[model samples]
Target chain A: MTERVRVKTMMPPGHVRTPAYLRGKVGVIERELGGFSNPEQLAYGLPAEERPLYRVRFTMEEVWGAAAETPTDTVDAEIFGHWLERL
Target chain B: MPHDHPSHSHEGMSPSGHPYRADNDTALTYWQRMEIAVRELLVEKGAVTPEEVARQIDTMDARSPANGAAVVARAWVDPDFKARLLQDASAASREMGFDIGPLRLIAVENTESVHNLIVCTLCSCYPRNLLGLPPDWYKTRAYRSRAVIEPRAVLREFGVELPDHVQVRVHDSTADMRYVVLPARPAGTEGLDEAELAALVTRDSMIGTGLPRTP
Candidate 1:
C-alpha cells in the first residue's frame, strides 16, 4: 500500500480538491504549508482552509495535446498539496 | 434576458434540451448550498475538522503534473501500446509509470469517426494524473447542464465545431470514475518518434475540442 497522502497548501489565489485528472504528474510546488485538516479552504475552488497546499504548473501539451495553441508553454495546476506515495 | 418566445431547453423534457431531471429543479446541488451546510454541520458537531478537508486538498494539488511532455510521447509510437490504451486506459497508463492516485479512471479514445467529450455531472471528477485540473468551464453549471443535452452546442462554445456526420458522445463525470478523452493519433506521425508526436497533443484536444495535428 502507498503511504498516507500528505497535501501542501499553495499561495493564494487559493486551492480546491485537485481534480483527479492532475494527480501525480510532476507539477511544481506553488505553495507548501504545514499540514492541517481544515475544510473551509475548499471555497474559491481550492483549499478550504489555511492548511498545507501546493500549487503546481503544467503545460497544455502535457495535459492535452502537444500541438495545443497557447500564449504560454505550461499550465499551472494545484494538488492536495500531497498524496499516499510508494517508497 | 427576457424574451417573448419560449426557450428551447425549458419544456421539461430531455429531448427539449432540458438537462436536469424533471425533478432536479427543486433539489439543492450538493456542491453548492448543501455542501456549505454540511461543512457547517460537521464543524459544529466536531465530527471532522475543517483543517482536515483543506489538508486533503493540499495533498491533491501537490501531485499535479508540471508537464505532459512524456505521456504524450509514449502514446505516439507504440501501436501495441495504443491498442492496449484503447482497451483499458488506466491500465495502459500504469504501464507508463503514471500514478493515478486514488481516483477511478476511464479513458475514451477518439477514433477517426467517433468522438467523446467529458463533463462533471456532480462537482468535478477529472483524470488528474494525466490531464491536470479541469478548466473552469468543466465545473460551471452551463457546461454540466448543456453538455448532456446539447453536446455539440457545448463543444461549440468551447470552439469545437463538428460536421453534420460526426457523432458526439458525452460522459458526465462524478466522484467515482474520472474520465479523459484520448485524441486519435495524428497522421504523418509515422516516421516521427513518440516524443515528436506527443508534442502535437494539446490539453484542449483531450477535452475533445481541438483536432489532432495533421488531420
Candidate 2:
C-alpha cells in the first residue's frame, strides 16, 4: 500500500501510458494493481520489464487548478512504477 | 487503360462514417487497405482462423446493456450479492452467468458521500461484454481530453448534479481493467420487484453519465 507519489514528467517519444495532464502532478496511491509489463517498452517490440502499477488518486484542484468547479472532486489513474516517484 | 471492376461498387457510409465514393476511390484509406491486406495475409498463414474471428465478432454483437442492468438490479435487492460484486466483480458476474472474458472488472459503488465515474482517456476501452459498444461521444477527442481534467463540469453537462460535500471520483480505465458504476438505488422504489428495478437501470447510469430512473 504505497502512500503518496508524483507522476514523473518523462517526455519520451512513441506510445506511453501516462497521460500528459498527470505529468509532474502529485497524487495519492489509492490501490496497488500489482505489476504489469512496461507498455512504453512493449510498444517498440522490446522485451518488457514488469513494474508495479498503482491506482493514484488526484484532487480536481490539483489537476485543473483554478478552473476546477468542485474542489473535492478526485480522479484516479493507473500509473506504472517507473513513472511514479515517492512524494 | 481504365477498367471497371465488377466486384467493387460505390457504396453507402461505412461503420466509421467513411464514404465509399467509387471502386477507384476506395472506401478505406491506403493505410487502412494496407492493414486489411496484412490481416488477410496473417489469416492465410493460419495465424488465426476465420471461424475464430467470426466467433469473436458474434460475442461482441451479442452483448448489450441489459447484462449490466441485470447485475445492478440484483445488487439493489440482494445485499450479499452486492458484497460479492464489490469484493470480486469478475467472479460475481461469472456467478450470474455473465462472461466477463479475460479483462478485469471492478464495480464501484456510488454511496451518498462518493460518486464514481469512468473514462478511458487513451481509447474507448470499455466493458463491451456487459455494456455493448461505447457511445460515439465517449470516443471523441473532447470527452477523452476533458473527462479527467473537469469531471464535475462534465457530469453537470450530463445533468448529474451532486452536492458540494459529496466527492466525485473519476476512474480512468487506463489499463486492462474495466469499471462499472453500481449506482445507488433510487428512493421510493422499494416495493418494485427485481424486474422493475432492472428496467430502471439505464446504460448511462452504469457508465456514471446519469442515474437510475427516479421513482
Candidate 3:
C-alpha cells in the first residue's frame, strides 16, 4: 500500500469524546503514533481492548491558529483509535 | 477507611468522630479528577515513558497558522472554488486537503449579499477534520446560550456589524455533527486567484465574526 497509510479520527457531535476544542480545525498528520485497541468501550463500561482505532500527530497551532499564544507554542495532539479518512 | 460496628447507621454524625461530607458534582471542575487520575496512572504504570511523553510534546513546536493562511489564500484566487465552498463546504475542503473526519461538516455561507450565523446549542459540536480545533469562546457557555437568543450581540463582540434583516439563520449543531460558517467573499477582491482569496478568509471570518480581508 502507501507504506502504511497514516490514519487519524474525530468523533461526531453527541458521542465524540475529543473536545470541540479540536473539531474542524486544520492540521497535518504528523505521524502514526502506534495505535489503541479501543479505550472508549473500556472507559464507558465496554470490554477493554475492544475499541477499534487510529491516531496520529496534529499540532495545536494547526487547530488553534496564532491566538493560542504560548511559549511552548506547538501542541502535538493525539487523536484517537478510530475515525479517519484519506488525505 | 473505618468500619462501623453499630447495629444501625448513625445519621448526621462523623463515621470516625470527624464530620463526613461530599462535594457537589456541579461545583466540581469538569473532568478535573479524571484528567489527574489518568495522567498520574499513566505515569505510574509506565505505559508511556515520561521522556517519550516529553519528546512527543516537543514536536508541537512545528505548528503554524498555515491552515488559516491556506484557507485565506484559496478564497483570494478562485471564484469557482469559493462558489463550491459556499455551496458544499465538506466536498470543497477535501479539494483543499482538509478531510472532514468522523463528523460531517456543513458550511453555511454569509455574504454582503447574504449573511448567516452558526452555533451549537447542545455543547460545542464541530467539524474537526477541516478546522483543527474550536476556539475557547466557541465552547463557552456564554456563546452556546447567547448565539440562539442574541446572535447579533455575539457577532458584535467579534466586530461583525450586520444589517437589520440579512436573513440570519442560526443553526444548532448537535453532538452528532457540526458546522462552519463560510463568510462571503469581500469586495475589491474580484480578480484575485484561489490562493489570494484563501488568505483573506481568516478563522474569524469563517465563524461569522470578522469579514475576509480585502485588497
Model 1 achieves a DockQ score of 0.02
* Angstrom error at residue B25, model 1: 31
> Candidate 1 lDDT, tens digit per residue, A1-87?
212332222333433344544444444443332454543344435543444544344433444454433312333333343342222
What overall lDDT, based on C-alpha atoms, would model 2 receive against the true structure? 0.87
| TM-score of every candidate | 0.50, 0.87, 0.52
Candidate with the greatest lDDT versus the true structure: 2
lDDT (Cα) of model 3: 0.56
- Residue A52 lDDT in candidate 1: 52
For candidate 2, lDDT tens digit of each residue in B1-215? 13334565535656544565566664788999898898799899999888888888899888889999999999999999999999878888888999878768889999999899989998888988778888899888888777777777888999998888888899888876789999999999989999899999998899898999976
Find the number of clashing residue pairs for candidate 3: 45
| Interface root-mean-square deviation (Å) of every model | 10.9, 1.3, 13.2
Alpha-carbon error at B95 in model 2, in Å? Answer: 1.5
Say which candidate scores most in TM-score. Answer: 2
lDDT of 3 by residue, A20-80 (tens): 5545544445334344545445446666563333323333345446643221122223445
Q: Report the first chain's TM-score for all candidates.
A: 0.45, 0.93, 0.51
TM-score of model 3 (first chain only): 0.51
- Lowest-sum lDDT 10-residue window in model 3 chain B: B57-66
